[model samples]
Target: MFRPLELFIGLRYTRAKRRNHFISFISLVSMAGIALGVMALIVVISVMNGFDNELRTRILGMVSHATIAGVGESVRDWPEVIKKAEANPRVLGAAPYTEREAMLQGQRVAGALVRGILPEQEPKVSEVGKKMVAGELHDLVAGGFGIVLGKELAYKLGVDVGEKIVVYAPEIRATPVGAVPRLKSFTVVGIFEIGMEEFDSGLAIVHLADAQRLYQTDGPDGVRLKLDDMFKALGVARELAGDLGGLYRVRDWMQGHQNFFRAIAMEKRVMFMILSLIVAVAAFNLVSTLVMLVTDKQADIAILRTLGATPGSIMGVFMVQGVFVGVIGILIGVVSGVIMALNLEAVVKWIEHTFGVAFLSPDVYYISDLPSDMHWSDVGLIALLGFVFSLLATIYPAWRAARTEPAAALRYE
Candidate 1:
């Protein structure tokens, strides 16, 4: 089959050697700019996506996707509530929990959130059990007064499993020495590392019975739930609340951490917009390159027009030329970017080792290593944006070339 006249000529112009080497160089520069911009955008967005995913796993995994509690601050019928929650297809698991703000005193004092959990059921609702660095979850028996410290918290307090620590509640109690803060002593039974500094530094786990005793409650504060689809947490919670009646209140993960994730999403958008400017600038280079090519080929264009080429066909030639530059750049960028993203963690480690530097510190960040997660959807969007920008850049110059007076161009030539 014969190719279209415009496309045939366009592809030729793209591959043909230019009389002005500077024009060829400009085309290469434009292509490089597009490739670099696309590569940067892909790598950065993938890293951001990776961070988002890691946070979800390391932080949210330790927390309940949703919680069901009575309006009175404690769920006396938590077993029934757990049954009700598990009845829902969306609910994966549910476990009773009691949480309170307290101070842990050991070698040093640190503010802590003490969570009361049932050893047998806690693993079903949260990942802390799986993340334990020392001891088993079943060791936390009712009335055992056993406590589990986060790895960082254990480090901070200079305590370990089988060791003892004191938890000071804010509640005041009548002591022999008048009114004083309520305090309890317990032996540490486990140390868990969830890979999140905030959780590992400020959170502790204890037996459900011990927590209830600490809080002076007969039952758990709530039933924490795990869901098959985390994004469906809010909807499922609302449905459960309706099914269970107003006496029960439901809360989902987004309620507590929406702002943090929202900030990350906004930053991603801002970065995209900023980096896209580089692609736009590179696309503009195509306009300049095509314009100079038109100047150099004015007589040739006149000859083509005299040979019965239409204005639209002339425009098509240049548009095709610009698209060639874009397609090549985008293809190269996509391949390189994907490879970089897939190996980013290893690459970052190598850089740190070679340069003798730490890019991310555990104390300063939630995670100590760089991460990357490449989504083909994001790659497709970047490629589309680059192609559109390059296509648009060709419009003005192509239009100018199409409108050239054949006689006048030939006379000048």
Candidate 2:
């Protein structure tokens, strides 16, 4: 409905000087508000994405993508299970492991989940071999009864490499006097730091044979598998379960830590909703600005109506002006937001260095550095929403302007 005449007049009105300077001030404020809201949304979302990615990487580095375990206490044919798992093209690596909760006594006593792994094959499924700080995975020998401790667990037990610690298994041994917990002494052979407190504070590693011997199990508890793509863990696990039949159980990495990731996703959605309100308020400001502009231009509107301009054309004039303002604000916001998100990490580091203050101290937080990962899709979504809000704000005021009576408007003028 908008002709070149409406377009020319709308552009002229937007650029033309007005007697009411307050209208200009309100328009500027609206633009600034939209820009600020969009920028904040982009930066916050990017940081959240970065944290999600960082945590996922660290956690997955220590855990397998999927696992297949026996229906009973141990998988007697674990090597066969590994072989079958490796036969799948999606499965990249597999290793057998046994796990049990035990108490370690040294200078002090601490509880931990002790895991048994084949040192030769461990590197294929997990990164513990690469994360050791004090010793190597090879130090955990089957007959020697050597153990690897997490850095925090070692500190809690007041033990180090070469020190001996007593391990008490949950299984009981019958004695002449009474039944007692099965116990063994294992020399600390290695220390590893995964950076996550859950692992670093409560995990111990030993040879698969040693764990089986200590727990009195005939074989390893399960087989862990690493896939070519971590995201496909669930599908691969399901296929393995079907192939292995009802005799085994299969689980994916996501099943073990669903709550943590779900909470993060919920928080992100809430943040987006809260931030969108800011842009909505700014866009609504356009309503008041257009109403005032329509009143100010009544005489001009009357002249155009008397000259036979249609009401639809009159409405289009104001709509074009409002849309132009919205587009400008969104463009400014998108450009500024993208730039800030890309440099947020560097900016945070600079501030910390200059002020001698740590926002995330290494002593207190596992992830000490500020991280930002910008996604262009988020920027585009924000811009689109801002424009839609701005466009909706112009409707009522434009309709009011279109309904003006030429005779009354001219008489007033």
Candidate 3:
């Protein structure tokens, strides 16, 4: 197959050494700009995606995806509710829980939500036991008024496992004193760190019996559920509520952390839009480069037109050239992004070590280190957008090249 002479010349012109040093430098700058923009977008977006994923695992893993509860009071015979909920294929595990808000006093008084959990079943529903940094899970079930505190809470109160902590909740005394804050003491049995400041600072866990007794309730407040896909929690909760004939109310994870997750999603979308402009600016460089090339090759354009080249073919040649520029830059960017994303933790560590700085601090940030999650879809999108921009950049220059006057060029020569 013979290729068009105009196309051959177009490619040749792209490769030819220009007499103007400024033109060559501008062309190189355009290519470099595209590469840097693409690479930065990929790396930043991947890190954002990584943080989103880490939040899901670190936060959702410790809490129930959904909860099945009665209309008013604590749930009695939660075993039956668990059985009914588990009957659905979506349910992974369910466990009864009793919880209350009270002040924990041990030289210092701080507000705390003491969750009552069954040692054997808690692990099935939450990552609480798995995240235990100190002490043992089984020790809490030994009926010694054992309790588990979060790392931050332990630090704040200056207490650890085996230390005694008093919990105060409103108690109902019918005799002389009316309803008053009930006071109960528990021995700290475990300390856990889930990398969540909110939980680590204000959450504690104890035996279900202890919690119910502490709350003066005969049964658990509700049943917490883990699902195969936690993101499906809201939909499943709605379905379960309907199945229960409205006798039971359902609450999902979205309700618990609505503001936080919503903010994150909104930020991601905004960042995508903002970062895409880097690609747009870089693409504009292509427009300038193509226009300059067209101006320098005016005689060649006239010759191609005299040789019977159609305007569409003229456009195709330059468009292909612009696309080539974008393709090379995008390929380099994507490869670099993947390499950096995969090793982001190490890279951050190395930078911090060299600069004597910290990227994330447990007290300041929820996590203690940098995280990165490379997404191929994001890479595909970046390359696609770059191609589109390149094509757009070729338009004005291509139109000018296609409209060159063949007769006028030969007359001037």
Ranking by lDDT: 2, 1, 3
lDDT of each: 0.90, 0.92, 0.83
Model 2: lDDT of residue 15? 94
Which candidate leads the pack in lDDT?
A: 2
Give model 3's clash tally: 6
lDDT (Cα, tens digit) per residue for candidate 2, span 1-413: 44588788988888988899999898888888888888888899899899988888889888899999888779998888999999999999999999899999999999999999999999999999888999999988888899999999999999999999999998889999999999999999999998899899999999999999999999999999999999999999999998898679999999999999999899989999999999999888999999999999999999999999999989989998888888888888888989999999889999999999999999999899888888889888988999999999999999999999999999956
Alpha-carbon deviation at 8 in model 1, angstroms: 0.7
TM-score of model 3 (CA atoms): 0.95
Q: What would the TM-scores of all predictions be?
A: 0.96, 0.95, 0.95
Q: Candidate 1's error at 203, in angstroms?
A: 0.7
- Model 3 lDDT per residue over 272-346, tens place: 888889888888888888888877777877887888888888887787777777777777777877788889899
Model 3: lDDT to the true structure: 0.83
Which lDDT tens digits does candidate 1 get at residues 1-413?
A: 54898898998988788889999999999999999888888999999999989998886778899988778777888888888889999998899988899999998889999999888888788888788899987889988899989999999999989999999987988878899888889999999888887898999989988888887888888999999999999999999998898678899998988998899899999999999999899888999999998998899889999999999999998899988998898888888888999999999999989999889976777689898999999999999999999999999989989998899998856
The global Cα lDDT (0 to 1) of model 2 is 0.92
